[model samples]
Target chain A: MDIKDIMKPENMVYSKTPVLTSTTMHYCPGCSHGTVHKLIAEVIEEMGIQEKTIGISPVGCAVFAYNYVDIDWQQAAHGRAPALATATKRLHPEKYVFTYQGDGDLASIGTAEIMHACNRGENIVVIFINNGIYGMTGGQMAPTTLIGMKTATSPYGRDPKLHGMPLKITNLIAQLDGTCYVTRQAVHNAAAARKTKRAIRKAFENSALGKGTSFVEVVSTCNSGWKLSPVAANEWMVENMFPEYPMGDLKDR
Target chain B: MAEKILMKGNEAIAHAAIRCGCDGYFGYPITPQSEIMETLMEEQPWETTGMVVLQAESETSSINMLYGGASCGKKVMTSSSSPGLSLMCEGLSYLAGAELPCLVVNVVRGGPGLGTIQPGQGDYFQACKGGGHGDYRMIVLAPASAQEMYDFVDLSFELAFKYRNPAMILSDGVIGQMMEKVELRPMKPRWTNEEIIKSMPWATTGKTPDRKQNVITSLALDAAVHERLNHTLIAKYKQMEDEEVRFESVQCEDAEHVIVAYGCMARICESTIEMARKEGIKLGLLRPITLFPFPKKEINRLVPHLKSMMSVELSTGQMLEDVQLAVNGRIPVNFFGRLGGIVPSPEEVLEAFKNSINK
Candidate 1:
């Protein structure tokens, strides 16, 4: 088949799933948020939970998760998406609720909320995007920034002596008895993307089964913040970020 | 039949919340207001009525948990003291922005930081004005007595659900720690799950393909859209002021001195009014029940007849500003308050009223 024919509307197999819409995403060219969003959308579609899913959008770069995910969406306060998700799930115990948060939101200001929610065994899903630096705020040092990661706020590289160690949310939440599933996955390559999708699905499934809190920490790339081309950013994330963050389940039940 | 039972103000509020069919109770233990959580925890309304009760790790978690429940169209609540309430401000703002119906009880103590765990009305401005951010207001109900504490829980829930806004019962340490005779009402569910879901179509439960997708967001990126949203919120606030403004006037119809007070201070002001009446001084009291709506019309009406108005509070003259605005310089407004847990007595208030009248 010709390339033109493959791109034609008649030849294309369009998904009629309620979870994914045709809306154009606002992500940067090399941003991994789109891929993560798509995977979440696909999972909601596959599970036939489009009409029974509620998503909480965080404050950072992915603050617009509501626009992409064709489900009931609520915009949470900065670093309060976990709390919002906890509220949404408890109120509608029959419905599936999840939150999409970034490193700055989840690991920093929102730490108390997420930790307590997990500790209380709140039946909800939390999708934490850990990109090491603050994306929307112009590459500031995040709580999850690597030891030598240099950003606007940590120009001389993140010093453990000065700024504390990088937070491993998956490991932290895994220790909590309330969390039934905890995983850290990357979305740098196609293989990693598939595993990240699986992690997202498992997180939602765990919540659906009333298995308490399920947390997925996705190691994503911020090309604009990293000051790299789309391809190079993915390569850099795979080489420098993934080994430190790791890609595996910390806890599963 | 208006039967009375002795109860602590916090306990009264807890009983009232359970009676009002509050579906979820999320809170962390805090001084003075801890009884509210203790009552719920011991009562275990969840076992009987399927209420979801969770003792959160912190005030921040509790408020957020309330946020989650509210988003699902559930009648949820959280109670805390001054310092704990401060931590919940961010979540409170989100609840208000999302227009979620929830009850937040702040049994206020003295504060700027962790000031004291004693009774004080320091949070008057925080509760009446926007506590968090954005142009938003909470339906602030000030309960002056144990009876009102019990009654106001239902009122707060009704107002919260009716307005699609967060409602707060602003009590104080005096009320929370003190016990009084309160009439308990039969428990009745105000709304079924179906009714609640039907009432809040905008709530983020889930979306079906057959219906238009609903987004509950505070963000309006465009300047024009943002302004329009703010305008809509302002209109709602105006409507609340018009329709829900509540206050109680005692002997104000034929008095020379009017005392403007609310919450615990208002209760004390009532006694002062009685004492002044016995002493042959023409004195009356104006007790605001809804602090945000503020009973401005009542204050304006009383201003023409008043020789002087003394605003009494448990804090350093916060509500006095509102009283001044209401009087609009038509009458002299004086302020009397005891900050950091020193509640002004009726004698002190009477003395202040006497001084204001002499001036």
Candidate 2:
């Protein structure tokens, strides 16, 4: 077969989702953000909800998530995305409203908003990206940072008595009666990406069904902030992060 | 005509919000303004008018909720007291920076820091000046009566959407707690989604193929772009100052001394003017209805006809500074106030006025 014929539409096995803007992503090479962004865009496109989805971007690294996602977006102040989503979903019950938040934004600065919003059962999806460190502000220790993990602020490793334990906010959210679907997934590999995409689609469906808040926590990687090669960061996340976070559905009611 | 009903100022706010076709009311409970949310919850507008009334966990959450609704081109509002309003400053700055239209009612109490629940105009500077960070101005309306409280909700929403800027009703504890006969406006219908999408092209009603995706944000990474945003906001504020200045002048046409006040203080100044008239002292009162657009031109107009100007407030010379700025040393500007939640009596104001004239 000719190369041109091989590159034709019928022969194509995969294509980029049109739900994403043509603008280049700012995520570093091997960063899980790009993969997660791709999954969200793909799911929105696949479901034909590109015109019905409103995204709330957080104040952390994914603050520019609005720039990459070709949807109507509202950039909230720090951890206030859930609060913003709550009102957006309440005011526009017919629309699909979701928030994309980083660990520092969701677990640290915005803990109150996240907890109350979940408790209220706002009927919105919360896409929590947990990378175990603050990626945007030069890898500072995050709420999800392991007890012995080292970062810019925790140079001597995180101590329980000093810095406290890693916050498993996803598990806490799963315990909330208001959350109808709560799952923790990853997008480090092709299989994992497929699994995460399925989880995202289910969460979006749950929102439309008016089941309540659907939380999908993506255990991601921050290669640049982790100060490791992209491949090494994935390895580190799999070996270190997966053990603590663990994959699979915590709650699916 | 809608019949008059005796209502508390805070309750009037709730009734007016529903009647004005507000799409949502997100607020936290606070003194002098708790009646707003309580009344909302009791009325259950969600069943009738479909107005979403939610009591948020905090003032921070409620203000951000308003930001959410307003971004979708909804007529949303929130009410709080001095301390609660203080907590909302960050959200207010974000709303202004994003240039989203919404209404905020602050039934102000005394405060430098959790001061008192009594009436005080100490927040005059905070409201008329920037309450939060950045160079931004909100359309501020001061309501002296329960009627004005009911009336300003619609007016505030109108100006808010007109300018795509935040509008505030800067009421105090006195007006909020006081009961007066208020003539309610007929109920207005809430807009449909299609109406919003058509009227507000910049709203985040999700992406459509025909138009560009709307992004509601206050973040500007580029320094030059941020500066341009700032310039745009300043120009909008300049336009508001030119076209939105609102005030009421009483007896200033033939007077030697003019008293300048706003909100509840203006009501008390009416009595002061009456007392001065009996004593053969021609005292006039210039009440500023819009605190931000600030009747500066009116104050300037009174400058030539007065021997001296007295700024009466519930704070220590906050609005007095603006009056002085308007006068610009053309005549003497005097200040009289009772601090820490004291609403000075008319006799007290009369003595202060007499002292100012004697000085």
Candidate 3:
């Protein structure tokens, strides 16, 4: 139980990836972003591609993702990370390029950018974090907000006629021929987090293989935005979110 | 041996950019400037110079793509018309704030909103002033001839990377569409990854174990820090004004009236000067090559010799305000312009100059 005993490599079964910066993240307690960022860092470290990976960070809670990840980063304008990633990959075809974007950033205003990038079959990876609500702007209804889900923007529960149905952007992108791999995973639990990490690793591997765009959607939870406890949020995601966005590979090639 | 070829202004820009060793081109076609990407595509310079050419979905995506490539310390560029450029204002602002170096060639066409596809100099205000929202400035190079279009492509990138600020080749429909003889420069090779890292230490060229990760961003949340960032940009502008002002003077040494112009209209006013000389009207011409710097000192120097000054343009006098500000009310600086894609003839321009002098 001593510090030296715990510090030994053989004694330690788990440790943070060096690819993750020591700088603290601003994600709320139990936020899925921290988990995903860690997963990506671990995978990048495992692949020994940390020196050649570049990230395009989106505008949202994760806008300052550059601070948390120890890799070259380009902070793209809101909803424009995919477009930015396209240029990065095209310019340096040898490097691994990926975009980390939120639902509001990808599914709504940036719909055109993502669609065209995917349709054009840009050799890049797109990591989409879809939590049912906008976290950064304070509990607003996001494009992936569930029906009958209440938030600041939809205080009286989301009405289908009023707010329209939540967008299944990953499913939509999966239909595009440009996307070689499309998968929906989660980070709410340990098993789900492991699966999401594998998906992210595969996406990066696919990009290196020049296999066109690879998309990995993480159906996450926003406990603070949902006004629920962290434990409750995981339970909520299991009972509610999983049915709408089932955790599995929707398409693969 | 390098060859001299006949080419359109837009094509000249494309060829010159390739010869200048541009690493990438992301553009969406717009009228009067579509030839830039078309020429690049036809050349397929990727096979030779390793230049990457991509036809983006829209102007918005094209500019953002430049933002990404420029962030990576690559020589990237994009070209578009007025309406398309309007769609890129936000990306331009981001580029400015992040201090990313890149070239933007605006083959200007008429516009307030999709005004026309014909030539216009109405974007003078947008290019000279901070086109987007923020306290920032970009090097605005106005090229008159198809040859200048070829020359300024390399020069614009040089100035852009020198100051880590965006530079624009502010051509017009007339220049973009008109053909002329161009002396092509010898081809240069694209920058290798090592060369990029050596030149742009701040560029996000991926992180190695020895080097820290680089980030290209403009977001500063703290009020004090953001204000200091604005001050840094302001100082850069002052430095550029002091060192980068460029212009051409024709017959300013012994003349009574001076005609101020730039881009395609400058070529028009040159003819007007000859016609006015025959009419016994001693008119000189001051053509600004750099619009943002405004050739203020040159205009002020010519202020003492001139009886009056007038700005001639293809728009409703967008550059006139700069000429007036340069003169600072020491004498009258009038304006003559043709709106809605009208190119003024030499006779009518001379008449307008005479009318302004008489008034």
Candidate 4:
């Protein structure tokens, strides 16, 4: 085929969104961040608010998310992204603001900031990525880690008395008065990817309408952190992760 | 017309913030400084100046709000007392590391840990040194009067943006609570989005097709990169020390004795000079306005012209060490201060000065 033919609009399928840059992402293979980042980029591109979207990227494997998203970003310290989002959304109500946080960041260290931000009814979106382990810190047990999960910090498996139960943060947030929409999802396959994209789009749309806090929690898999093959990780996530964190809309308003 | 208001120092801070075109003010109520936010709540600047004022759940949330606003290239600030300021240290460190411009007013109270609600300059070491972790310095402004509190709000923001760094107004309980006449400046319109793009080109206002997306971050994983950032911060501090030293030298010319003080203590020492001079002691007062730049050079210049120096403070001689460093052993720098919220009178300061001179 000629070069011109390859560039033809009619031949195009699954081209990358302009909202994401050509820069290579730092996320590991089979890490959920890449899928989540793509969904956000596609949603922003689709909404035509690429110029008005501000992202607060938190500390974790996805801390360098700004490099790939190509949107204005404020890199927040560990769990402080929600606090940053609250201010950004309030100060510029005309703009769309969101925070991309990990399980360790959101459910653990930054619990207070996230809880208060959601409770304040700040018009913003929160995209929480949850795996069972802290990926950046070498597979440590996260607050969302499964009760019997074995990991670096929980060598003998998580004890209910010592580590506490895995936090159902989305359910917790759904109970708050300020959150307009809250849902749990995953991106294990092309079908799931499309569903997650729709969910993220809904979140962005809600923020644009000043609909308080809209959250889309992605129960993602970390193949490296979980010490499993990418295929096995997906299978394990379906069999094991789904029962604990079932993929469905928990709340919507 | 810009009307002069008889307002408390904290209230003047609120008035001046509204007039200074602050885009947002996030704070939590603390003793001696709750009036700062309370006044903003009463005035409701949203109706007039379009300023966003929020009473945060805690100082932690307030400082992070400041971080968010600062990242967006907006003028934002927060006010708190010593204990509250302690709670904000982590956020302050993050703000400094990111090189974000914002204002933090510390209406200092006595504290080892919530020691008293009354005024104290005990946080001098915390303010002058890096209050947070890492190698960084905030431009610490010591406002001794209600007028200074009013004036320094604009000045702190100016310095904050000029250097792309945090600036602080380190006032004490006396300065925060005292009522006095203040000349409120004319209102400045908040920066337009286009103006912000022009001024803070690196701020994360929004991403445009023509420009690379702005990322306001302080993280650097590489050792070399982190070291270079530290060097840049050190250079900025050096520049600040050179250009931003502010102090009031009262009667230092040919005086035999000098009294070094700042904030409310400086105001008290102003009267102490008069009392000391009457007793045939040629005493002068060196009041440091910008405590971080520290007026070191100016104080050094007066060393040869002074016989002895006495440092007066509300805390147990917290600022005396800086005075000694400025003197650099050229003269005897005696320390005299009241601990745990004791406000010293001019006579007490004079007595301390006389005792030092006699010794």
Candidate 5:
């Protein structure tokens, strides 16, 4: 058989989801945001809800998530995505609503909004990307920065007494009665990406069932912020990030 | 004629909003204005008219909630007092930059920092001037009576959607808490989902197959694009200035002096004008209904007929600056105000007007 003849539809194993637009992502090389964005687009496409999904983008690296995802989007102020999502979901109950936020956006300035939204049991999905550093405004210490981790702001390495401990926010979210599903996953490899995708799909499904807030915290890698190569970043996340944020479902109701 | 019913100013707003077919209301409780939401909760518009009413966690959340609801091309509104309105300035700027239409009601109370809960017009500058950090403007309506409070809700939303800008009802605690007989309008049906989708093509309802995805954001990274947006906004403001100036001229046909005022002070000036005319003072009142597109033209038109002018406000001469600018040294304009939530009586205003004439 010729090579041209072998390239047939039956030979096709996988393809890109059309839910994502042709806009080139602005994330740094080896960044996990692209992987997470791809997984969300795939999940939206698979569930056939692209026309009815509204995504709220935060003020971090994924602020342009709206550009890549071909869906209705609203960019919220720093730390106010949950409040926006709460209103959007309440007003349009038939539509699927989700918020994509970073560690700094959710854990620092917007703690009150997140805590109240989750407590109110809003029927929305929250996709939290925990990279342990602020990537958009240059590398700075995030609330989730690991102890002894070094960033531009934490040049002396993060000290527990000075910078406080890394916040395991997913664990706290799991305890909220409003949350029906809370999980922590990663995308360092193909297996991990597949697991994260499954978790995302379930979160969307829970939204359809009118279940209270579905939260998925993705333990992500920021190579540029971490000052590491792409391959080394993945290895470093597995060795360091995974130990602090274990890969499993904390609450699945 | 519509039947008249007595109600508080804040309660009249709640009734007017429902009658105007508003889609949602997100607000936090504040002094003298909590009755707006209290009435909505008591009425249960959610069960009857399908209106979504939610008490947000804070004013920050409430204003952002209005941003979200308005982004979907829905009729939404919020109400707050001075301190709460201060907290909402950031969100207000975002709403204006995004060009979203919604209604905001500020029942003014005394304020420098958590000032008295009594009636005061201290927020005149904040409302007509820049309350947020941007070069944007909101259509401000100052209502002196409960009837105007009831009537301005529909007008504000109509103007808001027409211009694609935010609108504010600048009232004081005296107007918000007082009781008066207001003629209520009939209930207008709420817009259906299909109606909203058709009317608001730019709304972020969804990314349907027939149209492009709608993105609501105030962020533009490119300098040229932001500048163009600013130019467009400026043009819209100019249009408002030309077309939306509203004021009431009370007995100004043949007068020697005019009293410039708005909101509750305008009402007080009515009494002052009565007292002054009885004493052969020849004083007439010019009440600005629209504070942003102020009655500057009317003030100038009456300048040749007047020898002097005076500005009466609950604050210490915030609106006086605008009056001075309008007069432009043509007339000797004076300001009379009482601070710290003390409302000047008609006698005090009449005495001040006489003092200006002597000067």
Candidate 6:
């Protein structure tokens, strides 16, 4: 059957789920955020949490995650999405709550909030999107920016001598007793995209079980910040960002 | 049923919160107000009453936790002193913007920065006015004694849920630390989760397609939409001023001088009023109970009869500005305050009142 035939309203097997709508995406060509968002929406739809989920949107380019994700949403103060998610989950223990944050927001200004939320073992999920550079702010050097990486803020190669070493938040959170599940995944390709969705699903399931804090960090590509074509950006993330940040689960239980 | 038990101010707040059927308490330990968390921790209300008690990493996290809890239509609260409350301002604004009902108690101390742990009304402006950004107002209740502390917890929670707005108990170091005779009431949950959800169907628990997906956001990208939300907020504030204005008046019938104060400072002002009365000064006390509504009408009423009004506070003349606005230049308004842990005694307040009246 043709693509249109399968996707047609009357012919579709799954009804239009509350977790996603038919609104046209605002993402650029080859942008991975759209794919990542869709994966999350699919998981919510399959798990039947669309009616009982609250998602926090951060201050980066994906600040409007609520627009695409059909669940209830609240926009958090810059760098404070983790704290917001922590509060939201603690108040409604039965509901599935998660925060969608970028590297700049999660690792820089909101570092304290994320660290403590994990330490407190708040039953919530944190979906961290680390693109190595600040996207919306014009390619600025971010906390996870690799050594020798060049950007608007760092005109020359990033020098570990000057700027601090890259932050591996998942590894750091794994040390905290409160964190029950901490994993670093990526969405550079179709295979990695599936894995990212599985990780997100696990994170949400942990919250439902009241297992404690669950964190999933996605090493994403920012074509605008990296100054690469969408295809090249995905390749760059796999070749450069993944090696330094690594992709694996740091904590299971 | 009648019940009475002598308790300290901090303990009274904890007991009153339990009686009010608050579902959660998120707070960090700070001086004077630490007893509030301490009492709750010892009482272990979580096991008995299903109350959720969490000692957050800091005041910032505590307030955000309150935000999370309140979003679910739960009766939630967080308590701290001046410095901690300052850290909570950001979350406070978000909560107000979201229009969630929650209780925040500030046991104030002297400060521009980390001033002192002593009792002071330095947070008068921060509490009475919107402490955070945006055009919003909290339901501010100022308690002068331990008894009022116990009573206002229930009252604050009632007002919070009634309006679906954040309410504050603006207490001070003296009131928080002082021991006093207080009556503890029996425990009762005012509204169950189902009741609260039924009342606020718009709350962000989840999205049911039957209802339009509810978004609990303060952000309105469109200028007209943003402005409309602001207008609605202002109208609500005006209504709150009309409905929630509360204060206590003493010897103001045919009085020549009036002393305006609130929280612990109001208690001191009461003693000053007594001493001034003994010295034949004919000074009256106007103690503001709801500091946000500020009893402005009462002040306006006194402006015609009184020669002058003097404001006594533990801050550097913060509430005096409101007093001036209320007087509307009809009568002179003077201010006397002690900052940075310095608390003016009753005699000192009396002296200030006498001097202001003489002037």
Question: Each prediction's Cα RMSD?
Answer: 2.2, 1.1, 1.4, 1.4, 1.3, 2.4
List of clashing residue pairs for candidate 5:
none
How many Å off is the CA of B135 in candidate 6? 2.1
User: Per-residue CA lDDT of candidate 4, range B91-134, in tens?
Assistant: 99999999999999999999889789999999888888988899
What is the lDDT of every predicted structure here?
Answer: 0.86, 0.94, 0.92, 0.91, 0.92, 0.85
Q: How well is each residue in A146-253 modelled by candidate 3, as lDDT tens digits?
A: 999999989999999999998999999999999999999999888889999999999999998988999999998789998889899989998999998988998999
Q: How close is candidate 5 to the true structure, as a TM-score?
A: 0.98
State, as a TM-score between 0 and 1, how close model 2 is to the true structure: 0.99
TM-score of each: 0.95, 0.99, 0.98, 0.98, 0.98, 0.95
Best by lDDT: 2
All models, DockQ values? Answer: 0.70, 0.93, 0.89, 0.85, 0.84, 0.68
lDDT of 4 by residue, A63-159 (tens): 9999999899999988989889888988888999999999999999999989989998889999999998999999999999998888999999989
Highest TM-score against the true fold, candidate: 2
**Which digits, one per residue and each the tens of the lDDT, describe model 2 over residues B1-359?**
76999999999999999999999999999887899999999999999999999999999999999999999999999999999998899999999999999999999888889899888888888888888999999999999999999999999999999999999999999999999999988889999999999999999998999998899999999999999999999999999999999999899999999999988999999999999999999999999999999889888877887899999999988999999889999999998999788899999999988887786
**lDDT tens digits, residues B236-301, model 1?**
799999999999999999989888888888888889999999999999999999998889999988
Expressed as tens digits, the lDDT of each residue in A1-253 for candidate 2 is: 7888779888789889889888998888988998999899999999999999999999988999988989999999989999999999999999999999999999999999999999999899999999999999899999999888889999998899999989999999999999999999998899999999999999999999999999999999998988899899999999999999999999998
Q: Write the per-residue lDDT of candidate 1 for residues A1-253, one digit (tens) a residue.
A: 7888778778768654557677888889989899999899999988989989888888988888888888888777778777777766766788888889999999898888888888878899999898998998889999888898899999999999999998887788899999999998888778989999999898888887899999998888899998899999888888888888888889998
What interface-residue Cα RMSD does candidate 3 give after superposition? 0.6
Candidate 2 chain A: 10-residue stretch with minimal lDDT: A1-10
Model 3 lDDT, residue B182, Cα: 95
Model 4's alpha-carbon lDDT is: 0.91
CAPRI docking class of candidate 5: high
lDDT of 6 by residue, B1-359 (tens): 57677778988899888878988899999987999999999999877778878888788878877777777778889999999999999888988887878999999988878888888788888987888998899999988899999999989988988887899999988888888888777678646667866888977768776776667667777899989988887887888899999999989996898888888777878888888788888889899899887898888888888889988888789999999998888888998988777878899988777777677
What clash count does candidate 2 reach? Answer: 0
Better of 2 and 3 by DockQ: 2
